[model samples]
Target: MAECDAEWELCKENIQPLRQGRSVSALHQALCQQQEGNHTALNQQKQSVHQTSRLYFTFESELRLYDGDDPLDVWVRCGLLG
Candidate 1:
């Protein structure tokens, strides 16, 4: 969890530099570009999360259908769900 938080922080730090522009017009352009890029990225991320969740649910449902009981299945399922 700490590692995941650190990775997220690192990503934000990298994006922060691009968000803070060097000049007025440059800043405006950057801001506009950032907004557009963010919209695109957000859409992509949402789709990816949705697809991943669907896949996970499908896999879990299939596993349940097989009725193969395992203690670790829950953890594995949660990892995929995330």
Candidate 2:
């Protein structure tokens, strides 16, 4: 895990910066999900919210500096916004 963290730090500069920058943990989870062929939790939530028409905050939202802008932009850029 420490080795992965070190490598992540080294490659962070290559990731496109979002408004507040991407979450290292989120990126890690995304990579893990991809490797395991699992769907992302964020996408599941998005589907649920769409079907229920109910608002729910997400992990990404907690990192946002403002609420007006969509937090999915970062994921979209990373091709993780399923």
Candidate 3:
């Protein structure tokens, strides 16, 4: 686990920060998958997931509606749901 953490720290050095920080566990899993010698298949799977995520975010942004009257309404709705 310490070795994985060290390796992930090194790997993260070259990556640009996103709005949300990257996951350490995800990085460790990716490293393990990389060592399994299925680069092409793994790359394709990663690409597919990234593409789908991008599409979902794009659509969500485009379709989002805001009444602009009360931003706190969302929190109220969430609190009600919870």
Which is the leading candidate under lDDT? 1
Model 3 stretches astray by more than 4 angstroms: 1-37, 65-82
Give the range of the ten consecutive residues with the poorest summed lDDT in model 3. Answer: 73-82
lDDT for each residue of candidate 2 in 1-82, tens digit (9 for 90 to 100) = 9999999898776656579987899989989878666556667877987855432234345446445477776556444567
lDDT of 3 by residue, 5-71 (tens): 9988887756677888889999999998888768788888999999888866765554466466776
Clashing pairs in 1: none
Better of 2 and 3 by lDDT: 3
Candidate 1 clash total? 0
Ranking of all candidate structures by their lDDT, best first: 1, 3, 2
Model 1 weakest lDDT span, ten residues long: 13-22
lDDT of 1 by residue, 1-82 (tens): 9999988877774444646566788779989999999999999999999999897888777666665567567557656434
lDDT of each: 0.77, 0.65, 0.72
Q: How far is candidate 2 from the true structure (C-alpha RMSD, Å)?
A: 21.9
Model 1: lDDT to the true structure = 0.77
Q: Whole-model lDDT, candidate 2?
A: 0.65
The clash count for each model shown is: 0, 0, 0
Ranking of models by TM-score:
1, 3, 2
Q: TM-scores of the models, in the given order?
A: 0.45, 0.24, 0.34
Clashing pairs in 2: none
